[model samples]
Target: MSLRALLVLVLLPLSGCVPRIEVAAPKEPITINMNVKIEHEIHIKVDKDVEALLKNQSGLF
Candidate 1:
């Protein structure tokens, strides 16, 4: 009979409606293509005595 009661009764049904959300994966699988080129260089330094040993073509190498 009151205005507040009437408003509550009118809006009560609207509160029952909840939004539904769905998440689905794609039918086709995902593919990742990597065309990568890697280049590297190494530098070694030795003492003068070891360098002389290697230059002499010792069997150590």
Candidate 2:
């Protein structure tokens, strides 16, 4: 048999295995839930005289 004919016979079976590619998104909708809680507190310490002064002088700050 000819070399070209033999090569064609061998490669013909492999031609059926051509790769197939598919791109798809999720069937259900995508959801992102963020249950976040932010808590903060501030504390100020001053002497009795300073606290009284601040109360008497409203526009000091």
Candidate 3:
């Protein structure tokens, strides 16, 4: 067999593997739902002799 004919036969089988692409259009609106929750932790440290009071008015004398 000739070199040209052998090369043609080898390349002919590869032509069938060409990619085929397709596209489509949407008819309705796409809906997406995402639910997220965040939690926070707070810690406060005070002196050992200091007292915690909301309203202290006994020192008015």
Indicate which candidate wins on TM-score: 1
Better of 2 and 3 by lDDT: 2
User: What is the TM-score of candidate 2?
Assistant: 0.54
lDDT of 2 by residue, 1-61 (tens): 9999999999999999999999999999999999999998989999999999999999989
TM-score of 3: 0.46
Q: How accurate is candidate 1 locally (lDDT)?
A: 0.93
Per-candidate TM-score against the hidden true structure: 0.59, 0.54, 0.46
**On TM-score, who's better, 2 or 3?**
2
C-alpha lDDT of all candidate models, in order: 0.93, 0.97, 0.76
lDDT of 1 by residue, 2-56 (tens): 9999999999999889788999999999999999999999999999998998989
Off by over 4 Å in 2: 40-61
True-vs-predicted CA distance for residue 2, candidate 1, Å: 5.4
Query: What's the lDDT for residue 55 in model 2?
Result: 100
